[model samples]
Target: MIDPFGGIKGKELTNTSGFFVDKEEAIKEVNVSIGILENKNIKKPTFLETLRSKKSKNTEIHNNVWDYVPNTNNEYVNIHIFWSKKVVRSKNGVPIRALKVALVGLKAFYRQINTLKPDLQHPDILECYKLSLENYQNLPPIESFISSEKQDLLLDPFAGVTGVDIYKKYNDLKKDKDLTLEEVKYSINFIDQLELPKSKRDKKFITKKPKFVTFTFPTSESYLNVHLWWAGQIIQTRKNIEIGRTRLALASISKFIENIDVETPDLEIEEIKEMYEITKVKHEPGKLKTSRIELKPISKGGLSYWSTKTHRWITGKYDAKNKIFNPPKQNL
Candidate 1:
C-alpha cells in the first residue's frame, strides 16, 4: 500500500525545503513510514494522520505540470503529498489552510506519474489557484460579473445608422428599438398590409396539375427514312414504322424539354410547349425517368486503387441536333 502522504515530518522541513517523493526511493520511504508508526514514541498513523503530521506549508512547487508519457521516451511517475495547513503572508486575513488541502490532493496525483521516468526533473503538477472575482470576457451592462451579488444593470445594444438603419429596412424594428406606445400599435396595422408579391412562375404553376404519360421507344429505322418518317408520325397522329409510312408528313422536330443552353438554336417557345405532351413524367408526377440500378467493380485495367481521394462512376446522356452528346466531343 502506498502512502499518498509521502515522507515528510513537519518538524524536519526548513522554511525553504519540503520532502519530495523519490520514485526509486519510495519503497525505502514506505518502510521508514511504517517504522515511524510502530515506534512507541510515535502514533500509529492513518493516511490523513500521516499527512497532517508531515505537512510543511511554506513548500513550493516548480516544474513538470504537463508531461505525457511516450513509448520511446523515459517516463516520469508523479509524487503525492499531503498537508495540514497552508502558509500565509505577514498580514493574512483568511487562513491559507483551505487552499493547502486542495494542493496536497493535486500533488499526490502527480506523484504517481513522476515515478515512471526517474530522469524527469520537473513533475507535471501545475499550481492550483482560485480567482478572487469573476473576470468578464465581454463587458456586460451589469456593473460586476459576480453571480447572486446584487448588481444595477442598464442594458442596451450599441448604436448610430447601425441603429436607425434597421428601422427603415425591417418591420421587425418596431419591436426592438424602443418604439413609442402609439407607434407600436400603428406598426401592427402598417406591416399587416405589406406582402411579398407572388412571382410569375409561382402564379403559372402553383395550382396547375401535372400530366403523366408513358412512352414506348421508337423502332429503329433504315438510314434515310428515319427523320422523314418520324416527322410524318407525329403529324399524321399515326404511323406504321414497320412499313415506314405515315398518314401525315411533317418535319421530324426535336423534342427537348429540359434546361436549354439559351445559346442553342432552340425551337420556338410554342414548340417547347408541345414537347410536354411527350416528355411529361410517367409513373410519378414530374418524374422524367424511372429508376435504374447499377453496381460495377471499378478498375483502371482490373484492380482496385485505394489511393483516390474520391471514387464514383460516371454516366452519359445525348443531344441529337448539335450532335453534342450523340458522342460528347468534350467534357461537359
Candidate 2:
C-alpha cells in the first residue's frame, strides 16, 4: 500500500502528539473545494472560504468550521469539520503523521420571522454596536497586520483565562485604556447573538456546565480543612490571587480528593479577608460568595456577625454560666 502523506525521518516538534494534517496539502484541497463549489449549478455558499482564511492563510482547522445555508428544509445539509492536529514521534522515533481527519459536526440554519426590532432599537444597544463597529473599522488591514494574536485573543470566550475570576485579573493588567469592561461585555453579547447550531453527533463541540461544589459553614474540622485545601489550590493556579464563588468551590473539591487533614476549626470570614489582603485581590461583589454554606440559621443559635473593622467573623457565643447572652437576646 502507498502512503498518501509522505513519512518524515527526522526529529519532530515538541509538545505535539498524534498526527497533524499536512498544512500545504490542506490549503490546496480547501482552495480546490472552493473552486468546485463556486462552479456548481447553484453557487455554493462562500462561507467555508471565509472560515479558511479567517485566522491565517494556511488554516490548520485548529478549532472548528461550519458551512451554513438557511431556508433549505433539510434539502441542503450544513457541513462541519473539526480537525485537530498534534506532533508525534513515529514508532521508529522519526517524524509525525497527520491524524485521520474526522467529519463529525453538522449544522442546518433556519430563518425566523422577526418581531424583535424594538429590543434592537434600544439606545444603549445601538450605542454599543456603534462603538464595536468603530473598533473593527479602526483595526489595521489584514495585509498590514503583524500577527493574528490580537484577533485570536478577541475570539476567545474567556479571553484565555480559566474562568471569570481569572479573566478579571487578566483584564486589570491590560494597559489599553480604550478596552473598557463595557466594551468587552458588548463584544461578547455580539458574538452570542450570532448563535450557531451544532451536530448531535459532535459531543466534543458541546459546552459543558462549569463544575460546582457545596460547603456548609461553621463547618467541622474536616470541612475547614477542605476550605484550606481549596485556598492552596487557588494560590497555585497562578502568581496573582483572586477569589470568587466558582474558584473557591474548585479549591475545596481538590482538597477533598487528596484527603488532606483539616487543621483549622472553621473558615471564618476574617481568615478569608486576610487572604484577600495578602493576595492583593480586590474584594467586591460576588468576589467570595461561597456556595452551599448557610449565612444565618432559622433555629436557635446566636447570629453570625461580620466585623467591618477587623474583617473577621464574630460568632454568636452562649454564656453557659449565665444561661444567656451577657446583654440578653432580643425577642423578635
Candidate 3:
C-alpha cells in the first residue's frame, strides 16, 4: 500500500499486524486520509467574496464598505491595508476586524471595476474617483489627508506653538490706526524674504491680480478673513498698480503661516488710509433738471420705464392682474 503521509521508506509494505488487518483495508485507509488532506487544502471564501455573495441580504453595510477605500492614485489594496493598520493603532471606534473585512471587499471591488467594460462602467462616479486620485498624487505634507490634529503638527515647525498666537497677532495688527501704505509694503517685503518649503517656492504669487494660496491651521479661516480686509483696503486706495503687490503679499503670508515657529515675530500691522481727498459738490436746480423723455417699447418685447434721474430707459415689470406697468422707485 502507498504511504499517504509519505512516512514509509523504499516501497516496503507494513506487516498485517502492524496497523491494518489486510492490504485492501490498509489501501482504503490511505485513500481516506488523502481525501481528508485535499479537503483541508482547499481555500476558504475571503471576507470580500462573502460580502459580495450576500449583497441582497444587507445592502447598506455592503455600500458603507466603500468609505474605507482611499480615493488615491496609489494601489488601492496597499493604501487601504496601511490605513486599516493605522486606524487599529489609534483605537478609534472602527473595529479592526470590520476594517479588515472592508479592505478585502474594496480589493475585490477594485478588481471588478477595472475588469468591467467601459460601456458598463458608471461615468460620473469613475470620473470623480479619477479626479480625486490625481488631485492627491502631489498633495503637500501640510495638506495631508490625516486627522486635523496630525495635520496641525505637520504644519507647525515649532513643537509647542499653534495657530492661536498667529490669530491674535493678526487681530492686533488690524486694530492699529497708524498703519500706512509704506508699512504695508515693508511687511510684504519682510514676508517675501522668509524661506518657504521647496515644494511651495515655485508657485506664482503675482499674476494679473493677486493669487491667494490656502493654508491649513486652527485659525486659518480667521487669518484669511483679515487678509481679505487688507486686500480690500489696498484695492480701494491704490487700485491696479498695487494689485500685484497684494498678491505677492498674500503668497508670502501663506508661506509664513506654513513655516511658523517660536522664533517668528508678530506680523507688523499698519492702517491704510485713503490716498485721495473727496470733494462733495452741491447740484444747482438747472443741473438737476432734464428735458421730458419719450417712453419707447422695448425691442425685447417688454414694458420700459424712462429713468428721469439717470436720463436712461430702464426695464419695467407689467402686472398681469392689475393691468399696470410698475416702474422702479427713484432715489431722492
Pitting candidate 1 against candidate 3, the one with the higher lDDT is: 3
Clashes per prediction? 22, 2, 2
Clashing pairs in 3: 179-270, 179-271
Please estimate how well model 3 matches the true structure, expressed as its whole-model Cα lDDT: 0.28
Candidate 1 contains a number of clashing pairs equal to 22
Winner of 1 and 2 under lDDT: 2
Model 3 ranges off by over 4 Å? 1-61, 65-200, 208-332
By TM-score, the candidates rank as: 2, 3, 1
Q: Which stretches of candidate 1 lie over 4 Å from their true place?
A: 1-21, 24-94, 118-332
- Rank candidates by lDDT, best first: 3, 2, 1
lDDT of 3 by residue, 151-263 (tens): 11111111121112221232222222113323444444333422344355434432222223222234432132114223223322222323223333443333333222212
Which of the predicted structures, 1 or 2, would earn the higher TM-score when compared with the native? 2
Worst ten in a row by lDDT for model 3: 276-285
- How far residue 96's Cα lies from its native spot in candidate 2, in Å, is 37
**How do the residues 241-309 of candidate 1 rate in per-residue lDDT, one tens digit apiece?**
321111001111111111221113233655433332222211112122342211111232211111111
Best of the candidates, lDDT: 3
